[model samples]
Target: MYPKMLEVAKSEGNKEAERSFHHANEVEKIHAQLYQKLLDNPGASRETYAYYVCPVCGYTSEKEPPDSCPVCGTKGKMFKKMD
Candidate 1:
């Protein structure tokens, strides 16, 4: 998406848009770094149970889920399954 935006900016001769697109790409790289850090050192663990807690919103789901939280976009590693 950033590359596409940059291409559009180039075609439209919009220097500001091009610069903003590059800035967004830089921000994404920083976010990726943060994610990598979390992956490297996931803090703790919880005993698996039937109920699952969403790390982002604290919403509990009765079913096992994938990486993304249904309510708040938290990854599966963030969930704490309750007994």
Candidate 2:
């Protein structure tokens, strides 16, 4: 769905839509991979750390946020922290 939206956005020359849909598609792929990893290791130890999400692109990071969002170039300071 997101990939299709990205392609449509690109075809229509909507830069903002393209970026947003592309970011969502990429993030969903990462989420699937992480979910698979957890499923493969059900007993993995859980560690406590701050989780940060990019307000513009939905990019997620643990421990600390990046200096800049790799997806949408949003500044680290703009990230929303999750408890």
Candidate with the greatest TM-score versus the true structure: 2
lDDT of all predictions, in order shown?
0.66, 0.79
Write candidate 2's Cα lDDT for 1-83 as tens digits.
Answer: 77777778889999988876766778887677767866887774265557798998788876688999887789999999986
Checking candidate 2 for backbone clashes, the offending pairs are: none
**Model 2 lDDT, residue 1, Cα:** 71
Clashes of each: 0, 0
The reply for model 2, stretches above 4 Å from the true place, is 10-15
Candidate 1 C-alpha error for residue 68, in Å:
34
lDDT of 1 by residue, 26-82 (tens): 546655664575577677223233757665555555557556765446797788887
What's the lDDT of the predicted structure labeled candidate 1? 0.66
Candidate 1, TM-score vs. the true structure? 0.50
Q: Candidate 2: global Cα-lDDT?
A: 0.79
Most accurate candidate by lDDT: 2
